[model samples]
Target: MLHKLNLEHILFLDIETVPEYKDFDSLSDELKYLWADKTKYQRKEDFTPEEFYERAGIWAEFGKIVCISVGFFSFKGEERSFRTKSFFGEEKEVLIEFKNLIESHFNTPYHLLCAHNGKEFDFPYIARRMIIHGISLPQKLNLFGKKPWEIPHLDTLDLWKFGDYKHFTSLKLLTHILGIPSPKDDIDGSQVREVYYEEQDIDRIIIYCEKDTVAVAQILLRLRQEELLSDDEVISV
Candidate 1:
């Protein structure tokens, strides 16, 4: 059944995010109070707000996307190739560029966006950050007045769920179960904030983002019982 959907119609994507400010001390008094309130249930009882600040990246309200890497399958003469592109740097610039790409090329009925846990995380995070940056939401990301079936977003994690809402599967776990190569070998999402703020390594984050995007595509192919693209077939553009 999965084989019936055209691979070229799907855009596989992943994003890396970090706290809006470099540290809790940098946040305004209002924002600091808000963060503490927002994370009241999640943080441990003994952990102070400053100690728990590292997790701000998971919340769209307190976080900003540092990288958004996208991959899509295309053809060159009878051979299939997957190409990836990334938008990085400042939050506003990255959101603007990503929105332009979506508006220009993917704003159509036939194209779909896929991510690891996008329905829960990536898709809405991008939309919220775009709104914060005052950039218009792309047609694909805008959910206003759209029914569930009308939304074109696909989630690899959801697909793996098979209707068990209580179950959660991480992308890394899915890759392992399906025999796809793992993308989290070097640094995982937990380390992204430190890498971005302390190391100042956008390139490393972009590389990580692209690998997750590629892993999403590979996972989908595995579900479809199709051949995974060879390393040579993945081109960065």
Candidate 2:
């Protein structure tokens, strides 16, 4: 199925999010109550809401995207190259930039957006964030009444599952098993919140996000039984 689709029609992406506030105290009393309530099941008396705040970035309502990195394949005759770009800084700006890219360039029925675990995470997270900011949803992200086949989205993680609904695979683990370069060499998702809030290193997070995006693309190539992308074939622009 992957071989039937044009590689250039897929925009591969990953996002980095941090808690909406740097600390639990930054939240208003109402939000504090809401946070505690929202995470009740996940926390399960193991940790207080304050202590578990670092993981708040996993929830769209409690987090803001700091960076959204996207990569696309370009072909030149017999040669192919992958180019990546990132939108970072204010959450609204990052989202708006991404929306424009989708609406302007990849806004076609044939174009697809792919990511690892994206169907469950990246895709919905971006849509929710955009809605919160009053940004109109791009056609690709708006899934209101679209049937399953009508959605212009692809998920490598879903492909890897292959009907084994109980199976879950991390991008890093999948890449390793597939013999692709590890995208988590520098920092994993668990450390992203600290990097963004404490280290104030948006650049580092952007690189990590782009690496995941590239890894997602590479995973697809591997699934299609194609050669892995050489370092020279990947360009950050």
Candidate 3:
């Protein structure tokens, strides 16, 4: 088990998904077919089967990724700098860029990927879409057989759980719990499509994702500090 991780050796990533095609009346039957079991949290009201069948067409055509923001903090002795790279545009092109970045410098032997709920959402979605684009996943993404928890993935949601699964914890809630000030997330996820279409603005989504990356980094810092302090106290005692 990898403990006391070097943040510099970890890749913190987040991805946003859109339908495979867009500007259509109804989602393609094929895209709808791909929508099988992507949901991770419980909604207060159960969606009807027809309602649930929604977004399939959206995912099939454009099936493009709207954004992939990556952030990592590295230390020069004691000073650590947080650096990030965000890709937003055509799914194929954006995915190509994402693949190249992962393949380029992160080509180290192994690096733990830190994400906010990536086990359920981001990781597999990125993998499937990368295959869709005919892009081969990097060698480090070879953590195939391991269960979600078994991998070196650090999910802020799971850590927020504190072992209790009572309520669904959104990233905003997790940030609030950690006393970390989250960005102005007044806009909800449902609004992204409209904002992207009618407003013709992709900046909003990029900004939203950027804030999420910072939140992920902050959560990592908090966890690392707590764990390090705990270890140090044990040593002192």
Candidate 4:
């Protein structure tokens, strides 16, 4: 049963990352290369890592938190509704808003914060930004030097340990395997910042956030048990 995991107050979340500088001449070659790798994230273009980072700023700036999309969902009875909020723009303002939001409801009866690649990305990203904002992180989230498996983290990406460490697993692939229809709307994560910058449309970003959140939930469901989905679901983001 899903309850076996014993996640009481679960906040499923995903984040959008961006670097502080478009290209930081200050960082050394190693660090620059490291950052360049993340810039290639979810990109379909034939871009070398350097080109990816040079063309687009992502994962630079050490601890710049861009968009924090938190999806709060309770799994118990059949009645279900998820409260999701997204905070983006300027790291300081975003972190302040995110901290306020998290602090406001975190004391409520809840269990854990769940994410797909959160251990590697989302959780630390949020925690570091909170620290930058002089806001303490929620107790359960301050893993601080603990092994991921030893912590209260339920990273769905790591859960898919089908013995292929090198396998490139994605939220979309998980959706396909679990038969959950994805509502991506043909938008790619690479274009997220551009959409935010060019169109200045929060709605598109929110839709993207919803697509990823739903993917996170489905990934969690797959981890706890099997992927369950009814008809009328579409896949493509």
Candidate 5:
């Protein structure tokens, strides 16, 4: 099935997010209480809500997207090239730009959005953020009444699971086991909040995000039993 699908029709993507506020104290009193309640089970007695706040980015309600990097394949005869683009800045602006890209170019029944664990994370995160910002979802992201088979999203992790519901794999670990180049050479998801808030290095995060996006494309190619993309074949725009 993967071999029959056109790589050019899929948009491979990854996103970076940070807590909406700079710190726990930055949140309003009401929100502070809400955060505590929202994370009670995860935090348990080991850490306070303030300490667990760093991971707020995992949830769309408490976090905001800092960057969204996307890549797509283009082919000329037997040659293939991958092009990447990133949207970053204010959260609303980033969401708007990403939405525009989806609606303008990839808005077809045949188009698919792919990511590593996108079905559980990236896809729904973007949709929730868009709703919070009052941005209308692009057709690709809007899955209101679509049957399971009608959904046009691909998750590499899901494919790797192959119907094993209890099995889980991290993108980093999967890439390592699959012999694809690692995307975590510099920074990783755990450091994204610090990079965005403390170091104020969005470009670093963008590069990291793009690497993950490229890695996702590479994963698909591997699944299809094709060649991995060499550095020369990847272009960041």
Candidate 6:
């Protein structure tokens, strides 16, 4: 079945996010209280809600996207190449650029958006962020009435699960098992907040995001039992 997928029709993407504010103390009184309430159960008795705020980037309500990198496969005869690009900077600007790319280039119903755990994390986070910024959702990301099979988003984690509801696979682990180079060698999601707030380097984040996007495509190729892409075959735009 994997052989039937057209690699050119899919756009593999990954996003980097950080808490909306540099620190929990920066939140408004009302929002701080709300956050505290929302995380009470998850934080438990050991750690206070404020102490858990470092993980706010995983939540759409408390975080904002810093970078969104996307890659697509291109073919000329039997040669395959992966072209990648990233949208970075302010949240609204990043979302706008991403929206334009999806709306203009991959607007067709046949086009798919793929990422590792995208259905749970990347996909909904992008959609919610777009809504918060008053940006219209692109056709592929919007899921107002789409049936299960109709959703165009593909998730590597979901594919690996293969209907095993309790199984959870990280992108790093999957890449290791498939023998693809690890995207998290330099920095992982745990340090994104520190990199964004302390280092204040958007270029570094973009590079990391692009690696993840490429890794997602590589995972897809592995699933299809195809040769992995070499470093020279990937181009950044």
Highest-lDDT candidate: 5
* Residue range 1-237, candidate 3, lDDT tens digits: 233666777777776665444443455565344343343232225763235433432333335578888877656775556676789887778878877877786766556677788766777677777888787876555567866555656677766667886746777777787776674465645666666667768888777776677778777777656421121111100
Q: Candidate 4's C-alpha lDDT?
A: 0.64
Candidate 4 lDDT, 37-133, residue by residue in tens: 6555554577665545534433424535567677665454864445567777787788777667656665453456778777677777777767767
Q: Candidate 5's residue-wise lDDT over 122-217, tens digit each?
A: 999999999999999998999999999999999999999999988999999999999999999999999999999999999999999999999999
Off by over 4 Å in 4: 6-8, 21-50, 54-57, 60-63, 75-78, 107-110, 145-150, 162-164, 225-237
Residue clash pairs of candidate 1 = none
Tens-place lDDT digits, model 2, residues 1-237 = 789999999999999888999999999999999999999999998999999998999999999999999999999999999999999989999999999999899998899999999999999999999999999999999999999999999999999999898999999899999999999999999999889889988889998999999999999999999999999999999
TM-score of each: 0.98, 0.99, 0.75, 0.71, 0.99, 0.98
In model 3, state the lDDT of residue 24.
Answer: 38
State which candidate, 4 or 6, has the greater lDDT.
6
Clash count for candidate 1 is 0
Q: After aligning candidate 2 to the native by TM-score, how far in Å is the CA of 154 from where it should be? A: 0.4
lDDT of 1 by residue, 18-93 (tens): 9989999999999989999998888859778999999899999999999999999997778999999999988899
Residue pairs with backbone atoms closer than 3 Å in model 4 (clashes): 9-110, 9-111, 182-234, 184-237, 187-237
Q: What does the lDDT read for residue 116 in candidate 4?
A: 76
Clashes of each: 0, 0, 12, 5, 0, 0
Q: How far does residue 3 in candidate 4 sit from its true spot (Å)?
A: 3.5
Per-model CA lDDT versus the true structure: 0.92, 0.95, 0.64, 0.64, 0.95, 0.93
Candidate 6, poorest ten consecutive residues by summed lDDT? 1-10
Error of 5 at 160 (Å): 0.3
